[model samples]
Target: MSLHEQLYQWTASQGLDATSARRLRALSGVDDPPGDPWTPLRRGAGALAAGLIGFGLILWVAANWDDFGRAMRFGLLQAALAISLIAAAALRPWRAPLALAAFLTLGGLLAFFGQTYQTGADPWQLFALWAALGLPIAWASRSDLAWTPWALVVATGIGLWMETFGGHSWRFDASTVPVHAIGFVAYGLLCAGLALRPGAASQPWAWRLAVLASVIAISGTALGGLIARDVAPQFYLGLGVMGVGLVLAWRHSEVYAMSALALSVDTLLVVGLARWMSKERLDVGGYFLIALVACGLLAGSVTLILGRLRDAEARA
Candidate 1:
């Protein structure tokens, strides 16, 4: 536990008066050496600048596509990629932003290649390749500034692959196998994020993004099952995975994960109830009932999560 937390616990346990506790806190020097307030602003500015530069490069290429020959286009992208990578290696402080530039340039290069050659490959293939190639940059940067974007790229690739291979239908058929594949992929990402060392700069945001993607994927598949003629296996599997995730997150005192899982459960419950009501000739009373149940669930979930947070803070 942190020093401030220990001090608070000690004071509470000892039943110290307000003045005495204040004196003890002052003596502890926990409040000494105020940190730089500009750090967050600087980081945010750097990330924004990098994003703008990457996006501007893409737009410039697109706008001048007719003017530039094939060689010029490829040369421009390749040159940008090389320059970004070289600068990242040379400048330690600018590593994350430069790596991000390289990651974006790599994507642009692959996209131009596919367009130029007419590879006839699916869009997901391009994104997958981009993600695979960018993994090294993310690993080298060791920052969420890189990992978060990589995670997003991976999620987009998975979604596109699902759309291309799984089709739009949610029915329990051979084509829907890709839905289960996606669930497995989501679970894999969640597990990998959880396994990372928690003390790293990238850990918290990376894991949170993984959990978010997992929750969205599972919830979407499970909801689709509600519309299927026969229940899909993904429905049961997704619920089971969510149950396990909830238990693991609770054990680790991850309130964000718990809240996300609980919200998903609440959504499924409310939607399922509404579907059942529609089947039974639902009326105004039924609508009111659904609204009431939703409200209750929301309230209960909020209370439970807040209580858990309080308990965790007290323990800390």
Candidate 2:
């Protein structure tokens, strides 16, 4: 009937003598026995863990130091970063720290170069160093758990590079600024996959990053129109912008879809205005009207298709 009676009956059912049962009851009294929990097994495990982490970090630094003198070892955080990257690639356990290490190293390398330019000291070496760090940053981000930060940095790098190219002349000897700006756009697309991970972290930072990336990507296109004079006489730049927006709409939601729709509408209105402007006597208004109608039909068709799919699933 009562918990104590129930426990007594249970102990009696075990065929314990009265004295043995009473001793067992006393052992399980209100407080459990307190003692040091560090058995030989637990002590050995903690020691091993500490040793492995320390050893791995030490070896990682040793592998990446360049052929520089004692005066420069303090600055070899680059090499230290390289060491982290090397460990991430070679050791599966190091993947967890790969993102943090890669970001710090790449950003430090960038700052080092940017600083030289600012200091009016060793600009050539700065450029050379920046170039050298690029390879490892790319490689480091490719590993597990490190991809998101990698992608974000690459996107920002591209944006910075794009903004730089739009201003400078003969930015690169091989080609023009447009060539380098394209790298930024390409990097943004490649890193979009990293956006998916933040949803798992439950931290709003990941989603914030995704929104930031989209803004960066959109800005690059606007910058494209400024540097490159490559639009068709018969076509409009907004068409290209709208097309990009639609591609984004198909991939993700939020502001991207709305932006795409708004841009598409704006392009149509521009096409109409071009007709009034009279483009070689072509019917711009008619063409734009036709495109607008076509887009509306496509949207209705998609709705119908998705509705049917939902209905079928519900029946099942």
Best by lDDT: 1
Candidate 1, which segments miss by more than 4 Å at Cα? 1-33, 168-182, 194-203, 229-231
Clashing pairs in 1: none
The best candidate by TM-score is 1
Clashing pairs in 2: none
Q: Report how far off residue 141 is in candidate 2 (Å).
A: 6.0
lDDT of 1 at 215: 85
lDDT of 1 by residue, 125-214 (tens): 898999889989988987777877788788777767776667643455546866666645655664465457444533567667877887
